[model samples]
Target chain A: GESVGLHLPTLSVQEGDNSIINCAYSNSASDYFIWYKQESGKGPQFIIDIRSNMDKRQGQRVTVLLNKTVKHLSLQIAATQPGDSAVYFCAENAGSQGNLIFGKGTKLSVKP
Target chain B: GAGVSQSPSNKVTEKGKDVELRCDPISGHTALYWYRQSLGQGLEFLIYFQGNSAPDKSGLPSDRFSAERTGGSVSTLTIQRTQQEDSAVYLCASSQVGGIQPQHFGDGTRLSIL
Candidate 1:
């Protein structure tokens, strides 16, 4: 019954603005989490990741914040660009094998 | 170095036919995973392979779905008597190790069953 779910199905933002996508996971045992970006025809591309021990992790222009207390996760993209328009997903590493449980993606659209 | 590679960018077959999908993982990578993505949906874990360990097939949707890894590198997912419901994109990913590692993915093979 444990599931990883997203708070938003779609997010539209101006190209110069920042965007925030949210995810909530029910499995507290999951220690690792990852964010991926998927373009229209491409596979999911690794963006950023965070472990339970850490509350936040930063990548080139993205930041992943984890709130273990509420089992919530968020991805922040600064200066969103047209190239950054894609479907974003959050996945939790579950079980001993570390199989990822992915949330329904949030389609991010950046308008110029 | 190249990332994970999957063959036959697209596959079209009949409902009663069988199909084999291939995945060539990155060199020296010991972990491989298969996932299915229906249109506008999230990735569904199908199977995983880690080094010489037996593969974890827990996510396989049904007996019609099966996979195998040869010599710990290339992998093949076979679907027997495919159905219309089997139409989806099959994605392959690989990592240096299994647990908590960032996985690189291939463009995936789009399977269309008629």
Candidate 2:
């Protein structure tokens, strides 16, 4: 079945550094994409999202880049903090129904 | 500032037993969703319900898994004849009218099948 996946299963970064997580999606017809952060014992929290019309979207200290041709999506966190560490998932909405198909997620660990 | 709320944060059941999980979506939210997550993994889509519309149950793992939403506000996912693989965190989310809207998620229910 078609699904989204992450390039890195685990990422370790130092505090105050920048971290980048990458995702590859298979469905070409997807129109919306979103990033979510899940902390331990908690539900997934919305981080950032981008539409097919634009190639990039920026949130507070977070940026999402989309490359439609390659079906690649990335999340960049600036000045990474310990609290920023979590499992990050990228999801794609293929149609107007808004049903999201999620990626396996990448565990991000920040070393202080 | 009320978000989605789920009941019985954690549940422990024996194999072959039945369990029901509940979700209370954000007030006036017209869309509701259910997902299952294994430990250290991504979420698996379960079902979706739009106000007064038929639910999408394409993701239910087997015949034992079922869910229903009443009055477009509360939803319950029922699992019959549970097994060890049924243990996971069940998450529910809600959105505005359209699928283009961002989904707001609840804390989730942790189920452990013994």
Candidate 3:
């Protein structure tokens, strides 16, 4: 079965530092990717997204880098803050499918 | 003015009991979705609706799970003869379009089958 997985289950970072979360997807046909942040007791919120045509996309204080060669994707957060502590998940949109397949999220904890 | 809303934020029922979860998507949004998340598990796609047309229920885990959207607004997911394995957070999300659009989610209903 095709699946999306993460490199780490949890990541800890000091406030004001940088954080990077990695994900690996097995389905090569997946063309769209998105990153979502989920706080405790809340629904997952959209953070950023990137299409297969683009290798990298940047948002406020966040960046998503895609490497089609190795089927790897990464989300980088600059100047991480305490509020950035949450679970991050990477989802893939394969072909014309309306559903997004999610990865086992990475829990990010920021220490002040 | 609302993003997405789900009913009965938490539910507890015994095995073999039937449960119904409701979802009210944003006004004017045509696409709605239902997903499940278990403890320490990722989001599991369950069903999707596009307007009042036929829904794509391929993601549903089993024949015991079913969902319906009414008037292209409110949706309901029903689980029959729920088992202990059915314990999970039932999340509802809505997007402006079906594909390539960011999905807005609700807090979800946490269902526990004892």
Top candidate when judged by TM-score against the true structure? 1
List fnat, each candidate. Answer: 0.71, 0.73, 0.69
DockQ of all candidates, in order? 0.81, 0.80, 0.76
True contacts kept of 2: 0.73
Global fold similarity of model 1 (TM-score): 0.98
Q: Second chain of candidate 1: TM-score?
A: 0.96
lDDT over C-alpha atoms for residue B105 of model 2: 92
Question: Would candidate 3 be rated incorrect, acceptable, medium or high by CAPRI criteria?
Answer: medium
**Pairs with steric clashes in candidate 2:** none
Q: What tens digits encode model 1's per-residue C-alpha lDDT throughout B11-112?
A: 999999999999999999999999999999999999999975545888999999989998999999999999999999999999998888998899999999
Tens-digit lDDT string for candidate 3 (A59-106): 999999999999999999999999999999999985464688999999
Chain A TM-score per model, please list them. 0.98, 0.98, 0.98
lDDT of 1 by residue, A1-112 (tens): 8799999999999999999999999999899999999998899999999999999999999999999999999999999999999999999987767679999999999999
Off by over 4 Å in 1: none
**iRMSD per prediction, in order:** 0.9, 0.9, 1.1
